[model samples]
Target: MLQVNNIEVIYMNIIQVLRGVSLEVGDGKIIALLGANGAGKTTTLKAISGLLKTEEGEVTDGSIVFDGKRIDRYGPVEIAATGITQVMEGRRVLGHLSVEENLMVFAHNRKDRKEVKGDIEKVFEYFPKIKTLRRQTSGYLSGGEQQMMVIGRGLMARPKLMLLDEPSLGLAPLLVQEIYEIIRRINAEQKMAILLVEQNARAALGIADYGYVMENGRVVLSGAADMLKGNEDVQEFYMGLSVAGSKKSYREFKHYRRKKKWVT
Candidate 1:
């Protein structure tokens, strides 16, 4: 449903961030982009969502096409209108507004005013924990609640493609599991396409049909999720596993360098 072809992103006309990065998101499929910090996963999303322009970052080469239309030069509003919604990493919420109000904000652009209420209920169904908190001030909610609220807000837009950046960030392991399950359900039920950017390789690969590994702004590896899960390098580097299936210590893993196969 979406394609990023050899795109290069540059910030302030000088600092290049994404170099020849390319990937595809099939209709209703979960595509995971796995990488650590500064790997340019988020920047790729911004380029596709046109959020890059906000930070003086521009896609200087290649193209981003969604639903067969080129959108590399479009602005954030235009991109959002084209059925793509990016749930940014920080779990940003309207601090002063009620939870329901935050969800309502995204639906304002839709002409289906009456159905907006129904959609709010749909979001509540996905996140029942936030239902009773609808009228409460969003800023007072716990971190997990805020994360649920933000994903629910993205649902309000009724996007065909959702770019999720670090949805599991700063949450407990059980809570992360809950959210990832919800994400999987959202894809299956809504037939929505999701490009999930995550550092939690295990969780992301669990639900993803296909996955890409990024490093230093380039794709180092790409494969089916299960294949990646079984890969020795992926197991060792991302999952902290040794060849013998034992967990490696952080100190041991940190000193290891990734293979230079993609570096030519």
Candidate 2:
């Protein structure tokens, strides 16, 4: 459903971030982009969603195509209308609005006015924890609730392709599990294509059909999710598991860097 071919993203016409990064999200398939902080995972999403232009970032090299249409030069609104919605990392929500109101905001552009309420109910179904809090001020919700609300809001747009950036950030382990399960269900039931950017390698790979490892703005590795899960380097670096299958501390390998073998 989406393709990013050798795209390089530059900010303010000077600072280059992405260097020949390319990946794909197949129809109704979950693709995971795994990397640590500052690996340009989020920037890739912005480029695909056309949110890069908002930060004075441009895809100066290569192209981004969605549903076979070239969208590298498109603006955020135009890209969104083409069935892409980015649920950004920060779990952003409107402080003053109620949870339902926050969700309703995304549907304003929809012509299906009557069905909007039904869609709200569908979102509630996916996130039953937020149903009771629908009329409550969103700012007062807990962090997990806020995260659920934001994902639900993105669902309001009924996007075909959802770019999820760091969805598990700052949440408890159990809450992370819950949200990831919901994301998996959303993909299976809605047949929505998802490009997931995450530092939590285990959770992302668990549901991903395929995966890519990024470093310093380039793809260092790419493989089927199961293959990545069993990889020694991936186990050591991302999962904190040693070759002996023992859990190791990040401090034990702080300076370790994987030898890059870029997928061609």
Write down the TM-score for model 2: 0.95
Using all chains and alpha carbons, the TM-scores for the candidates as numbered come to 0.95, 0.95
lDDT of each candidate versus the true structure: 0.94, 0.93
Worst 10 residues of 1 by lDDT: 255-264
Error of 2 at 225 (Å): 0.4
lDDT of 1 by residue, 9-116 (tens): 999999999999999999999999998799999999999999999999999999999999999999999999999999999899899999999999999799999999
For every candidate in turn, the CA RMSD to the true structure comes to 2.1, 2.4
How much is 56 displaced in model 1, in angstroms? 0.4
For residue 57, give model 1's deviation from the true position in Å: 0.3
Candidate 1 has an lDDT of 0.94
What TM-score does structure 1 among the candidates reach? 0.95
Stretches of candidate 1 exceeding 4 Å from the true structure: 249-264
